[model samples]
Target: MTFVTKLSFASGDRDVLAETVQELKDTLERKGAECKGPHASSPETVSVPQYKRLRAGDEFSPWRYDVYKRSMEIHGADDIARDVVARDFPDSIHVEVEVDRKKPLGHRRD
Candidate 1:
């Protein structure tokens, strides 16, 4: 039996996101754990229209920004994965982790 630790990170600040991911990858690598990736997802554009006062005829350009995401899988490294999930990160960054246990697909014949 083995576990796959899926980690996802998101942030509006690209630099902060990259730094956080890199630090995690480095820690796992230093511990000699097998890591799959820091797979990047397309930036999602988020916009919110700004309205001036309560008037029904006034509106300003929408505030626009991109949110970046990165994902990675850690194979058979439970301890390392736990440490990563437990570690503290910047308040502006968001991190999520999921653990999935895997078993052999077929019955074994002795």
Candidate 2:
């Protein structure tokens, strides 16, 4: 079975989160990590205020939460995972990785 990497985060700034996600995706491609998904997907993103309230938090003192996700298939190995972990990340949020249920079309099978 193939492994994968997922970088995700929650933030109080939706625009920043959006930018980070895009930047990550671009970095993955420019650095040639064999990424896929989201190219044909449109994930539902929420604003800082809306996100807080959606999670049942008070807007006045928002608990600081937002939704952002980026996924890259690791092919039959974990090269993608190692590469992503080696990349630099912004100070505004955190990143976490996970496995993908389906193989990303962009990943090389060999």
Candidate 3:
């Protein structure tokens, strides 16, 4: 069974928020889960190189308190959200997640 997971964050900064998101992604992957989706940032723009590093998992750094909101449509993921939630995020940041118990099938309901 699969489900749609919507992760949201309210932080003091964007840079650090991005880092936290990346770490969460890694953590999810490590726990045998897969995630995918586009991101919406308040800055209105994310550089190309920055995107590349994040995609390649090579741009993690210490950042200020920043809130991150990550919405993922995932598969075969259980307890992953709980574990990720347990991670220690920056004090200046807050993370939230909404998990929808519906698997995303390729077939559309026309």
- The most accurate candidate by lDDT is 1
| lDDT against true structure, model 1 | 0.90
lDDT of each: 0.90, 0.58, 0.62
Could you tell me how far off, in angstroms, the CA of residue 48 lies in candidate 2 after the best superposition?
Answer: 13
lDDT per residue, candidate 1, 1-110, as tens digits?
A: 88999998999999999988998899899999999889999999999888887866688988999999999999997888888889999998988888998876794756
TM-score of each predicted structure versus truth:
0.88, 0.49, 0.57
Global CA lDDT of candidate 2, please? 0.58
Q: Residues 21-62, candidate 3, lDDT per residue (tens digit)?
A: 777777677877877753665533323333235365665443
lDDT: which is higher, 2 or 3? Answer: 3
